[model samples]
Target: MSDPIPSADPLDDLRALIRGAPGPDRGAVAAARARDAELTKPAGSLGRLEEIVEWLAAWQGRTPPAIHHPLVAVFAANHGVAERGVSAYPASVTKQMVANFAAGGAAINQICIAEDISLKVFELALDVPTPDITVADAFDRTGFVATVAFGMEAISGGIDLLCLGEMGIANTTVAAAVHYALYGGSAEDWVGRGTGVDDEGLARKRAAVEAAVARLDGERDGLEVLRHVGGREIAAMAGAILAARHQRIPVIVDGYVTTAAAAALHAIDPHAIDHCLFSHLSVEPGHRRVLERLGVKPLLDLGLRLGEGTGAALAAGIVKSAVRIHAGMATFSSAGVSERGVH
Candidate 1:
């Protein structure tokens, strides 16, 4: 049978949407700031939250910002490297967790319901299988560019906002391996105690990363490392970020694995950074390094290590607050209050 034609590029579609989207109004910002100064509190007493609200207004190109149809897209998959005894959890956990997510038993499901945000899950052919996870358009390529390109094109939908998460056992090994290959560091530099792996398990995990790197020498680009050492979910997340940038939708990235994927995407297109929001700092040892490399400051640092978009889901509340404050707060003139804190 002939292969089916691919759909229109989501990134291109997104760019068109953003081009037509309105830019923030300076008049609205001035009014909002003035009203914020008079909001029955000391000027700037609300700290960064207040600033976040103002920034949201600007991002939405309105005096009062609103986020309509916010979306959280979770990508789940398993890693082939799990067979190497690198992770504390079994590969079955990937399928089980995905089932939990589908059944509303996962943290992300509950959070999304509580927050009233739309959630969609994709399963890449990393390891686990889910009926809902959409496959990428291109076949898996052995080389880097092809693999990254395949991943990037998979989920380029015109989502309003995106959150990246992964669910692969031993996938952290793949991330560390990618890091080692890209940074020329020892596995020890990127390895961590993923999912409560004991010291010996951690050592084994580190060895797996080193092995993957050694197995794919001279493959230095993001796509090649991804094909050789990256998980399917990671690759998909990288693609999703690229699509989000092309669509001009902000992407909220979860912990170490997802951030590593983001790094790969940024390597492909630096402009992608402008469309990203680092959600939280994960307790994973390598997460900080990855975020630092990306020059991103997360909105929160709650010592979280859960990988199923849990951190990003929690951080979504903050984004919601920013939107609400921007759209709901009264202006100084509207409230008949003096803008005494003008500076």
Candidate 2:
């Protein structure tokens, strides 16, 4: 064979890392499944919980998959789209919410405290709101790379599980625009009442998304789409997810904003998703469709529209419980219980 040609894209290294990331360990999965079959319970009695064990074992390359040092990172930023009167909350709310997060006044903070999960909020693109995507690129190429880099850095260290969340005014608008760009469709299908936008404000959000979609470059799925319609925090979360996979740290994904980032990365490279778990479904209209496109089901559907990683923190406990059940439950032989066929 001839020598392979070298790639020149700035994102090539990251892309290579993502694409090269390993999936769940098949040997571990086989062992876990065989063990499950021999357990006291009937075949597939635990449903997705059983499957979660398989997934965790496969990724950790051990039986009863492990969830260690759960970390939640909420990327906070401001979207220029918020300035267009699309969101019920003002752009200043993004900053105010960031303060609230730091002060432990936000929902995510209380959830993290109760769960004993480490939570950090990266104030990305706070002072510098992303440019209005309808009229110009939200961020230049370097800026996009830098934003992702900031997230990757924040998530560094040996984290067993990482939960991603976002806090940005009008980010849903940006996410809707990105969704439309990646998976072509009516903006109406992706648009929703972000932060309780009224009918008039929702209409304005749709109009903005439609215009942004109309102007997308010939390049439909790369940095162009991001700079055109992605929020800084969205980009940051995407980067963090990708890096978590690269580092063998699985991610627990939160609501719409975090899901939107995951979707964008999924569009880029689906393999990255092997390192992630869908935490919950949000009330946001676009969330279900995003999960559908991802071909995964969330662990919870709690009518959550609040972001800031609250969903991820709640789901973290469930993940640990799954592993605990897998590791702790007595086997058929150990418990002296009759096997399914015998009983």
Candidate 3:
């Protein structure tokens, strides 16, 4: 399954980079933390901001890191399970929302505009959806490779912070299935009311996820689990996270669906987690379990369940401000202020 060249196999390239990806620069992290202590504000006064700055420094391999150009990629794809009434909205909404995102009409578009961050929607096409996870592999190998490459190409140069988002109907079901596959659990433990599914719909969603989890018999440590339960967009987000870490760009993971991709990516390479910042802990029941397993804390918790990278865009500003403060603020020595506890 490992192809040496990109032409032979695309997924191989991703796997290759992820396997070889280096750990974050510890020297940069130490220097950034040292700088944070010298800031005019009290040590650790900025709370998460201080941690964010250090994260940016280590990921970018530089101290005083700055979020020069923030970019959010909203990977959109359809799920075959959606045809089974898991989501409240029709599957057509996935394609329609992609147009809305393109036309600058969605909430994420407006958020990107307000924050001055670029936004792009990667619609994996509505005509061809991933197979139902309950029966067959959710994604084709070739298409999965293409989606990952597409995500990598979307990320060009001059990108400081990478925010990952998704737009797919019934994706929470897909996410829950992957979650259950990754970590053994009951359907009730992983399922959530995605898109505000009614009681009966939620029950159906859990049943579908449970069935999907039961169908897995492949190698647990390989990509078989993801291929069986992950959608193209989810695969692409995993690729993007891998690509971001391969490039040493710090990535901000959105909500449950995005975190699911992060989870899948982490399964492949635990080292990649060092570059990821969980934007928020989603209300989705399974998200907390994933976050806990990863041992990473979410930056914000505004009860955000909307999945158009809204949580990511909202967190992007805070991350940027952290860098700006770390880079632009004067030290107490420069400000001519007496050091704390100086007799």
Candidate 4:
């Protein structure tokens, strides 16, 4: 056979990584299923919880999966699009919120504490906001790739489960633009009143999304679309997703902004995000469309639009419980319980 594709460019390397991701471990899945059959509860009574256990096993390549060290990583950045009045809050809010995360005062902190997951906040150059998407590309190729690499590094040490989220003013608008470019939808189909923007602000967001995509003139290469419209935090989240697949770590992706990041990778290859489980169904209208296109359902539907990884952390709690039940529950033999339908 001829030589495989070369990765002379960083974006080319990213494409290779996505395409080369390993598939689920069939042996691990079989082992998990065998154990599930021995549990005292009726077969499949645990519903998706049982499936979650198998999923964790298949991804972690182990018989019984456990969440010993789950992480909630939230990347924060400032978007130049915020200057267009697409969000109710100013760009300064991005930096302030990062501070809030650091001070342990944000909702994400409380959720992580309750769920026993560690939280890390990455602030991507608050002083250097991405270029306004309506007028220019969001990031040059080098900077974008570097940011992605930084995100990949976040999956270090002994993280078995990763929950990805973002904090960026006007990133929802950036996400809408990227979605429209990648998915060929109208601006309204992707735009939502993020951060409680009023009617006029919503109109501005739609127009900004429209203008940003129109500037692309139909450029739909996943990385190219991201380079043109995706923000730093979005790129980082995408990188985290990619890295999680390579490391065999299961990921719980947060709401719209984070989902849009995964959607970019999904556009590159339909199965690029197979390792990621969406955390929740955001009230944001675009999120449902993205999930439908990806052919996956969220773990919860608390009408959450907050973007600090709260939804993903909550989902992590459920995943933790699933693993606990699968590993901790007594087996039929051990408990001396009679099997169902035994004569």
lDDT of every model, 2 decimals: 0.67, 0.83, 0.84, 0.92
Whose lDDT is higher: candidate 2's or candidate 4's?
4
Model 2, backbone clash pairs (residues 3+ apart or across chains), number? 1
TM-scores of all candidate predictions against the true structure: 0.79, 0.93, 0.93, 0.97
lDDT of 2 by residue, 230-309 (tens): 98888888888877776767788998878878887777777678778898989988889888988989999999988888
| Residue pairs that clash (backbone atoms under 3 angstroms), model 1 | 23-61, 24-61, 78-127, 123-133, 144-223, 144-224, 152-239
Model 1 per-residue lDDT tens digits across residues 262-291: 776555445455556788988878778777
* Top candidate by TM-score: 4
On TM-score, the stronger of 1 and 4 is 4
Using TM-score as the measure, name the better of candidate 2 and candidate 4: 4
Candidate 4 residues 1-343, lDDT tens each?
Answer: 9987666688998888888899999999999999999989889788999989988998899989888999999999998889999999999999899999999999999999999999999989999999999999998889989999999998898999999989999999999998889888699999999999999999999999999999999998899899999999999998999999999999999999999889999988888888888889999999999899889999999999999999999999999999999999998899998977432
lDDT of 4: 0.92
Best by lDDT: 4
Error of 4 at 307 (Å): 0.8
**Number of the candidate with higher lDDT, 1 or 4:** 4
- Pairs that clash in candidate 3: none
Q: What TM-score does structure 2 among the candidates reach?
A: 0.93
The TM-score between candidate 1 and the true structure equals 0.79
Q: Which stretches of candidate 4 lie over 4 Å from their true place?
A: 1-6, 341-343
For residue 269, model 2's alpha carbon misses the true position, in angstroms, by 2.4
CA-only RMSD, every prediction: 6.4, 2.5, 2.7, 1.9
